[model samples]
Target: MKLLVVFALTLAYASASVLHGFNSLEDDTNVGIIHGHNAAPGQFPYQVQLISPEGLQCGGSLISHRWILTAASCTEHFDNVTVHLGSIRRSAPRVTYIVSKKDIIIHEDFNRYTVSADISLIRIPYVKYSIHIKAVKLPKIKRSYPSYDGCNANITGWGRTSFDSTHEPEILQYAKVGIISIKDCKKKFGKLGKYIWPSLICASIVSAETWEGDTGIPLVELRSSVQIGISSVDSPKPELEYPAIFTRVTSYLKWIKRHTKLPL
Candidate 1:
């Protein structure tokens, strides 16, 4: 769980660094979330905050009234975790949700190299206050959709904007890209030959130099506004490529519901 890789130009201060981006994976045919202006600098959706006094646990997602999805390795246990939404940076005074995390579900066969099952979900505190905060909606399980091409999508996070660089973004940033079929991504990424899985739909500029810093942090598609992909992984090489990989949400809809104990 030593997930310390990054991308971008502005290097971290004598230390470390990363934004708009897109990536995907869906059993359904077509879906996408385009990049738009961020909510605001002071907005972390549900008053969520990072658990770190400084740089600690990776952030989590609120899928329901009582759950937050994040990396299992990001926490020591569940209770000590912090949930921040609304504000972009981790230190911004977000409306924090303090509670115990439970019902953890790590991909049964998660492998960093392949990213086959590198996903998980859990419940968090139900918000007690009213504001511009809410959990992102997961896609419905029963609906079938068509796989689309050139579907606009967006992703925002403070992940590394460049290779092995540690300069993470202070304000929440975003970028735009589109979804592509595994067949095409394979043609481009065939050299890596190991990490690509049918479960991932890559989102990246087919040809372009990336801005100084941006990677990971899930390139999400707003399929009718519900989040469907967590940025997974993508790269031709640290110096030569900016291909970002994303986890397919539809592939795991069953797993999500089964683990989170929800009716799909």
Candidate 2:
């Protein structure tokens, strides 16, 4: 299937705000990055834009030549996925691949209600590595949970740039954020804090906020250049000062390796 321009639509939970959504590409209702600057070419070679047949958009990361890592919520209800790669500009990807539903591997224990186990993988044809396209590194395999508190990270996507904006940026946008302790994050979320399990990470934006369409994107730790989280959810009320939530990658390393058969 050919890539089509689509806008943003929110896929929120019962009483909480989520960052994933569906929107028309031609309309300005749900458009660009929230307070983030345009990303430089090849700055995030592993980044990919995922589009559902219904025009729902999310982000993913290339973990191997044939495997993509993303949010389970992004693939849970969408199929015939269209993935754009090797470019910072959404309209000018170096290559685009159409993946079937059978190729998607979502965490079986995923719970949409709590956004738990919210990670998934997509299988695509083997792609050669290039300056514009490369796989991201996963955290080292370990039996214990990894801690990333206070680490600086970079988040990129083509999601809405502002809470009240009606346009999504055609070019990829990114913001720097700092990983915060789950304790602090839970305190900030109040009742929503119950969902902030150990497998989920919380981050506060150092600059721009992450909004709709930014879900499923990668959160790379700046120091190690390793992808540690997947954008999962955020508060709808920009004024609440809630932390952006991510599905912790290290917690699922074995799960990803089992499905992708990669030495992650």
Candidate 3:
């Protein structure tokens, strides 16, 4: 199974490339949620759609009025991004912001090949909080990584609903997933299990699966509504039943605080 890191971006020279080991899917048929449903207006206020200059898309979460947390792979190769927020429909957002490369901060140790240290932060012009636009709570900073095994979580994005389709939904899509231990997740990946590290978290596919463009979306605990992960990479083959991996948010709390300078 090919592990797709998701998102396609065009370089400054106008050459297109997928993140990490990703390859573009051929089909262009429009698809909706995968074993999920359309999110209601303001249901996922923290959710944001990140669009590169060349039109490639990825997902991100608003952690503060001026800060968006996303996958490093989404912004590592590029500096500028168009962020859409406060709307369920991608076409008509309540607010839009353009962030320059100077405000985009990727992890210093980010590795595109191994997809390690896959988290990033993008700062936008400060905006007032509203019902349709709000920050998601993050896990508390601690010396040790927090575990949420078997906990219910939700992921939202406009990514392709299936592996074969390249189409992304116009409306925001969300799915309920269950968190699993890294040990169990490693067993599912088999030979690829070595890449499963403590800094990352895994979630069972359940009836739904994440596809390209879902990268950088938040994985929020259902009980407390606290974000715990950022969408990282996953196998495109659903038949393998590989658990989706995400950059554990708890593991980077200090990094975030240092960069964003926000009090937890």
Q: Best candidate, lDDT-wise?
A: 3
TM-score to true structure, per model: 0.69, 0.88, 0.87
RMSD of 3: 4.9
RMSD of 2: 6.9
lDDT winner between candidates 2 and 3: 3
Q: What total of clashing residue pairs does each candidate reach?
A: 50, 20, 0
| Model 3 C-alpha lDDT per residue in residues 19-94, reported as the tens digit of each score | 2122233223445445668899989999999999878888899999899999887887776999999999989998
Once fitted onto the true fold, the runs of candidate 2 whose alpha carbons sit more than 4 angstroms away are 1-17, 20-31
**How do the residues 1-264 of candidate 2 rate in per-residue lDDT, one tens digit apiece?**
001111012224421125521222222332465556778898899999998887778888999999999888788876578999999999899989999999999899886665578898999999999999999988878767558999899888888865567556888988788899999888986765666688888887545556667778899999999999998864544546677788999888889989988875
- Give stretches of model 3 more than 4 Å off: 1-30
Query: What lDDT tens digits, residue by residue, belong to model 1 across residues 1-264?
Result: 112333222211111011222233211211112222333643435323335334543444556666665533344333454556656654564466554444455567765533466565545545543455566666788777445456766565544334334354455545556777777676765554344567766666642112222222344465554565665443424434435555677777888887777665
Please report, in order, the local distance difference test score of every candidate based on alpha carbons: 0.48, 0.77, 0.78
- Return the candidate ranking by TM-score, descending: 2, 3, 1
- Residue 218: error of model 3 in Å? 0.4
Let me know the TM-score candidate 2 reaches against the reference structure: 0.88
